[model samples]
Target: METKLTPGGIVWKIFKIIIYSLMVFFSITFVGIFVWVLINSFKTAPDFMQNALGLPEIKWDYQNYFDIFKFEYKNNNLFQMLGNTLIMIAINVICTISFPVMAGYVFGRMEFKGRAKFEAFLYVLMTIPVIGGASAQLKFLSALHLYDSYLGIFILSSGAFGSGMLILTSLFRGLPSAYAEAAYMDGAGEFTVFFKIYYPQAIPLLSINVITSIIAVWNDYMTAYIFLPTHPTIALGLQQLQRTADVHGSDYPLMFAGIILTMLPVFIVFSFIAKNIFNSKDIGALK
Candidate 1:
């Protein structure tokens, strides 16, 4: 069966080919970089320098991976650092997702005065970077006596004006209002209507927020470096390992190994949710 292609069909095929080619190119580059890092993770500093793009010079290159656990950063072992990271993820995830979803419900479903303006304000603020005010933030944390504390970092990271707010807002808006009306008819109050009627439906979208927070909090080192001096995370520990590498004299491979371990959790989690997170219609995809 032979069929002649239209001009539009031929153009579409060409576009498809170009897109596929780019995906393949970028995928290869990404995988190649990761593989290179993994390979280098096994090599000694000298071995890495000598055979940057090749296999490890020595047969037994797994010692660096072991050294990660053996070495301690400021008296905090790698597992303790990992524990701190997990705790941070839990606290930050709850703080970040909880308030936004609550506010998302209010502004999203319930119409009120200045709602649109408030939403606009959040959108404007989103474009503004908070990087410049690090000193002020540090001072603020100190003023609250929360300096170098988990609570301080939690408060700092849990801003409501983020994509979670926007996405969950849209999700709530797209939901059926009839459920709330039915709840109200059953003598349910606002809290009941929200908790019983609406909140459950939002789990999928909220999971996205949780997943994002987990990855973000997992990778965030600066906050821990600044505010959690007592607790070191894998991300911050990796940097500390590099900075102290001269003193250690051979921890470069250990640093590389730590890097791999640090990214492993995020990589595994992203693999599962990449399609959903990357989807064009985020709210619609959940529904």
Candidate 2:
């Protein structure tokens, strides 16, 4: 079949071309900057200052990677800061998956009195910015003695609400109820129906949520700064490292090295889960 392009089709094609061009331009710019930083990270302070935009004159300075571990901020070494960041990221991912799974399944699949109102409430809660209640939240956490503690941060981040809830709820609703009904006919318990049946099906969506939570929490410094002054995460530590580098002067290469090191974990995590996220078949399957 031959089709002629209409005026609207021509306009849409032009729009798409413009959008793709912008995307390509920005992607190249980002990669160029990243490569420049990586190349400079290998050079000495003076070498970097002399040729900020050029490649290294000598072999790569592998020591810069090791030196990152030795860098300290407020008595917290790189290892300690990395550990703190990992802990928070792990807690955030777990809570985001687990809490949303249970809550979303219940509200999405089951019929119960006041369920509509509860869903409405969750939607309203999403409208409220987290920072809007920072003062009260800080006071509340302090009153409960959760401030500056891992458990406190875990609890604070483990709310069974927000955009994730809405997404999971919709995901559950899209699924056929026959699966759960069959499991029930076989005398399966609620736990089996949820954990064994539908939960496994939700893994793809959950993986996406995990990646998002990890990246968000990994890059988050403000929350940790106020709630956990004693336990600085990688992001907070990076800020401190930058300040310390500035004080010493001519240590921008080392600061860039730290930035690369901090970014590596996020890249690794995303790579591992990227496959699962893109393959929607795993999530779309009835089984």
Candidate 3:
């Protein structure tokens, strides 16, 4: 049967079209800028200055990419920075995912006293901006001798009470309770039910958190700069590189090369796992 569009439906369709148009416009602009940077990365100093937005000459300089990896600081290179980032990300993933999943499962499924009060506390913590806690965090890290340490960052990031925890809790709440009941009837314990049943269902959300967390940590400069001045993530290192470029502005290609390298790992990781992250229904597709 054919149905006529209501006036409200027409207005909503117009609104969606306008929004989609804007998204496409901005996306194109972003791609254009990225392409410009990539082109400049291969251009010579004279060619870049003369034709900043133009394509590269017949000769493309591939050395900038190589030189960026060779960037040295106290015997550390790009490879060491990669290692440090992976290590921090590994600890962060374990701590963030494990605690949140457990906490979410408990809050969403289990009946316990003071649950309302605990949730209120989490809401308060979530509403409080992190900037307000900077000084106290510094003091706490100092007291524990965790300043300039990956373990310190891990501890800070592994909180069970946050927006992510709340989101996971809500997701778990929305899931059917029949699965849990069936598992329990089969003699499955709380841990077994959560791990084998609930956790698999939550994998999609978990993947989203993992990607966002990795990107956040990868691009964060201020936190690492304040707490771990000795340890330089890619963002901090890029900032240092840009500062050096201020002295030698002509070597802009090198800086652009570094920028590309900085984005590479994130691109690779997302390309591999993006389907799993976004597809909430397609469980175990990758495996």
- The global Cα lDDT (0 to 1) of model 1 is 0.83
Across 163-187, the per-residue lDDT of candidate 2 in tens digits comes to: 6777778888878989889999999
Candidate 1 residue pairs in backbone clash: none
| Residue pairs in candidate 2 whose N, alpha carbon or C atoms collide under 3 angstroms | none
lDDT of 3 by residue, 1-287 (tens): 98899999999999999999999999999998878888888877777777787787657888888888888754568888777677777877887789988998899888899998988887787787766687898899999999889889888878887667777888888899898899899999988998899999988778888887787788888876888777777788888888888888877888888888788778887887787666654233221
Instruction: Indicate whether candidate 1 or candidate 3 has the larger TM-score.
Output: 3
Per residue, candidate 1 scores C-alpha lDDT tens digits across 40-89 of 89888788767788888776488878778976888999999999999898
Give the root-mean-square deviation of each candidate in angstroms. 3.3, 3.4, 4.4
Instruction: Assess every candidate by TM-score.
Output: 0.84, 0.89, 0.86
Ranking by TM-score: 2, 3, 1
How would the candidate models be sorted by lDDT, starting from the highest? Answer: 2, 1, 3
Candidate 3 worst ten-residue window by lDDT: 278-287
Worst 10 residues of 2 by lDDT: 278-287
Alpha-carbon runs more than 4 Å astray in model 3: 1-21, 273-287
